[model samples]
Target: MTTPEPDSQVGIVLVSHSDALARETATLAGQFAGPHARIAAAGGTDDGGCGTSPDKVAAAIEQVDQGIGVLIIPDLGGSVLTARLFERPSAVVVADVPFVEGAIAAAVLAATGAPLPAVLQAADDARTYRKL
Candidate 1:
């Protein structure tokens, strides 16, 4: 079978307690990154389980991790556990940053081929947007 060409867009996953929050966060992140960026999201279901299970997260990473890398943005503490539970290929990177600004900045940077550390640093610096 012929292999599909790798995609250059960044892949993003959002894990949150609220599905709406996750989707909204992904949408806002897309806005920040513009239309060309590739983004995928997952969230917690009504029962409090992260909408994307460990297996599912791996699959999503595989799906999006073409030539570009996949970045995971988790909502809270447990969300980190969920991401950690999955073992992904080298094309995926999980950022230990908060879900809000962290995910957004990472998505934007990933779209531009920024290194994982640089992306994480940018996400960490995103706190500037939290002004009252």
Candidate 2:
């Protein structure tokens, strides 16, 4: 296995149809993961509408990538489609998991300096996470 870079955690990108939702989800993730995790929100359009933007998503991925890799958690519909456009095996992975929960789990694991695979696993594992 490749050794993780020192102080470099897997980046996380949260994509949603609403800008506020993405921003808020990132904020909530920060609250749980602390301040060091590289997380970004990509939502809505440049004109601030109720849709996802490829430009915004690309920019967010660029903003957070630190060479470790980036995990993208997309809400649904076009957001998922947009995220898929940027998927690169080693550099970026579009997670197939619940958006909010995946973001939280990914952020928490990434913050702990977990490897990209481990962080991705955490996000995937969140699919079955329960509140009860």
Candidate 3:
């Protein structure tokens, strides 16, 4: 099989209390969305502790940005608050949806070259998704 062409689509960032969780989730989202997806992880404190860091989050956002908007999915607690700090009316958006599900949904939609609004909508829609 041949590789797909890279597209300038919305990026995704996963913020979590544990660095491992965020990194693994980003990997899962990237894998599901294929190699062209832009996903980053901003988890834990800068000192390798259990917490969130604005600096780390900002770096992740920069790492994945491709002139398009980005979607930030925070795990919970302070991570959500930190994620909100980067929210912008056009270039950046924070999705208040389930962490893993939202990341996967956002990444998948973004990989298809969807716009920020569409990617955000898909992530939000994942909140109502039933897995029964």
Q: Write the per-residue lDDT of candidate 1 for residues 73-105, one digit (tens) a residue.
A: 777777678876653555566776767888788
- Worst ten in a row by lDDT for model 1: 1-10
Q: How well does model 1 score by local distance difference test?
A: 0.68
RMSD of every prediction: 5.7, 4.1, 1.1
Report residue 130 deviation for candidate 1 (angstroms): 5.0
Scored by TM-score, the top model is 3
Ranking of all candidate structures by their lDDT, best first: 3, 2, 1
Q: After superposition, how far is residue 96 of candidate 1 from its true place, in Å?
A: 1.8
Task: Estimate TM-scores for all models.
Answer: 0.75, 0.94, 0.95
Candidate 2: tens digits of C-alpha lDDT, residues 34-99: 878789999998899999999999999999998989999999999999999999997899999999
lDDT of 2 at 124: 98
Error of 1 at 38 (Å): 1.9
